[model samples]
Target: MSSDDHGLLPAELAEAARPAIAEARGKPARDAARILAEAGLTGVCAQEDDGGMALGLSFALAIAEEAGAGQLRFPLLDQILLAQAFAGQDIAGRIAAGEALGVIGWEGARDGLLRLSDDCDCDVVLVPTGQGADLIERAGLTATPTPLLDPDAPQIWLDVGAARKIGSLSGEQMADLRRAGEALYGGFVTGAAANALALSSDYLAARVQFGRPLSSKQAVRHHLARMKLLLEMSRAALARSLARDELGNPRDTRPAFLGAVGNAIWTLEKAIHLHGGMGFTWEVPLHYSLRDIRKIETAFGAGRLARQVAQDFIRAA
Candidate 1:
């Protein structure tokens, strides 16, 4: 279904989300959560009874893009997914109301240790199980921080031995959550790339060398053109992934997600390259986008995801 079919345009939602997301940036986790929830972003896909807007994943995808572009540190994606996943539960209501925070262990299992996206200050974590997933209380788990990539917001490892199960999702619900995650994350990286492209383009246009803008150089122009091309393609791929096929079945999202990651990495790297010496410095914000995209790439195992997509195509052929 199209954005229009949802009775709310994605662009409109994105415009509405930008200010709130920007406000939430650099704030404490709970404060950010309050800002986002008040703006109706944390529960965009949740049930109305749970204090959500009761929208679909497409709306959430728009919000995710805004979050990514703003470099929001909070786990907005996890909050939205969990709120919807746990629909009728009090936890869902709490999450939607910004009274509680939730995160997901994107990798590993509940039997041992699970890997979360980042050092999110959360109240509960959803860990994978044999059937689906269990929402375990964070107070009961031990969190080990991995600050190699992003020291400000590091990846976290959780020891998962018999934490309190506050909620659960069936296998089907987990599958749905995964699909929505792919689409939302695709939107996210695309947004990050878009920001990087804008920053690079603006910088190049204004940074004059030899009495002419650096953007006037053929080689520099070529690089900017390629970045723009890839960014647009990634956006298109993400949009296509969110749409149903002609058979009215959900389209496979792996290709789009993988493609977005690769494209974002390339765009971010090129953006840094275009900035020359300043790109390597902490003063320039381009590296943050690069780091974020790389973290996502590592989390998803882009190489493995691409191979899986290829294998599926080969079998169908």
Candidate 2:
């Protein structure tokens, strides 16, 4: 969000995706993402011919960061990242065929039956009920029935089993996918903070106060300055991760992930604080930006990621 340090996005992809997003709500959103994911992004894995993207994590990452900036949400990262966890398998192909909806349970971080867990034009549920982890299911998914904080996102419930669907991905690979998802999610949250910052900054600049504009006040200036710092840091985090991913270096990802989540959390939080009272109101989308970013930070495991990084460093010593 901050110009202090900026990362580049794929202009062609973003431009192409705009119309698709404009027409799509929920199901349509999923479809467009699937199309993009299945089309050329499959190479993200080591073996491109094997339904892997082989595109390197950085390129895939650029897509994620851009998605975040759009105020758009879709399942591209979830599905592709999960597909990588199933390397050498036909999972990506199935997703391409529209047989599978990219989904996973966010609670407890466990795998299961995935009953009626998917909705919005998806063909399958993929739930975690009393049954177990099931990759395939036609129906019998129940709706969680929440009003939904995100218009683009809806909630669902389903039965699930304790375990199953573990694939060729070794523990390391599985861990990598989880981290990748977290990093991308963090980038998303970062984008939301950015969108809010832009809007808030513009409003403050034009609003007259104390015979001039709030911009003239020292207090407001300091807040805006910090906001700028947050945005720059977010960009740095995102760029670092993307470069590491592109280099195919896993070691570099650790700090990258950490910084991404941290940047987003602080960036969005600062935006809220800067907006003052208006930021808290429902009419203002700033609150939603904060909320959505919080969800991403929650998934990225702000606390867990920090702990794991420290633990890894200790063990390495």
Candidate 3:
């Protein structure tokens, strides 16, 4: 019965997310992320001592779905979850205290080089690149506001010398953290896709087409069905991965993680296409959600997921 509640998000998480996204629409998602840290919603996968909500991934996925539907750009999930995965520690309270602002850039080339604050939002940055605090001492970096397709855009500039490694991750732990980042990142995309579909659905249901509601069109109904299918697939993939983690099995999470990325990528692409010209324009917000999903898709190598899928197919064959 809350204004924003449509069953995609839990009552409390949905409420918290809606306002935080509203506040960030003016500034940046980084600015809105403070609410997540304060609410203890960011590090949902973190340990008890880590100042996290200690919530499970299914709940997180549900929240992500609503966030996407709203075209919300808050970095609560990205900053906090990535930070915890990087450090294996809960620093949400530090983030809430404003003593630190967490930001992450996925380091694909150097798995050993931990770039904790490459976004440089924090006063004391931690990097697995090296622990000399050298990254902190680098004063010649600038932050740039990179406007995304959405109103809530965040951008940062890193001076080449502005980062250094503080620690290293190896073996299974390293791989697990990487999967964690991909899964969480893709989860946000799934959320965004869900949001776009809802927006489109509402518009279709109300706006007249051929002297009737767009939803009355058989073709329109099909498009909506396709969107829902993709959305559900992404949600289930994320859920399965998180459930595995809950069951004390981390090894099989990668496929579920990758499945989400692939499903979200396809779903958002369809959403934008179905909305036609309006989806391309800034006046309509569906593009924002689509664009955000694309951003995460590219960052997490969604384009390459087909190869992984094919390999799995071959293995099964």
Q: What overall lDDT goes with each candidate model?
A: 0.84, 0.55, 0.56
| Poorest 10 consecutive residues by lDDT, candidate 3 | 128-137
How does each model score on TM-score? 0.95, 0.72, 0.74
* CA deviation > 4 Å runs, candidate 3: 1-16, 86-93, 96-98, 110-162, 167-170, 245-248, 305-317
lDDT of 1: 0.84
Q: What is the lDDT of residue 181 in candidate 2?
A: 65
TM-score of 1: 0.95
Highest-scoring model, TM-score: 1
Stretches off by above 4 angstroms in model 2 are: 1-54, 83-89, 94-99, 106-158, 162-168, 242-249, 252-254
In terms of TM-score, which candidate is stronger, 2 or 3? 3
lDDT tens digits, residues 30-97, model 2? Answer: 56655555444423432444555454455556556555665555555566565555556666555543
TM-score of candidate 2 against the unseen true structure: 0.72
lDDT (tens digit, per residue) of candidate 3 on 1-317: 12323354454675666665555554544555666555555655454465555555555655665566566655555544544554433344455433356554444424323322124354433332222112132244444444543334433334434444443445454455555665666677777767767877887888786699988989889988987888788777766665545556664555665666667666666666767777677777666665666556554455566577578779999
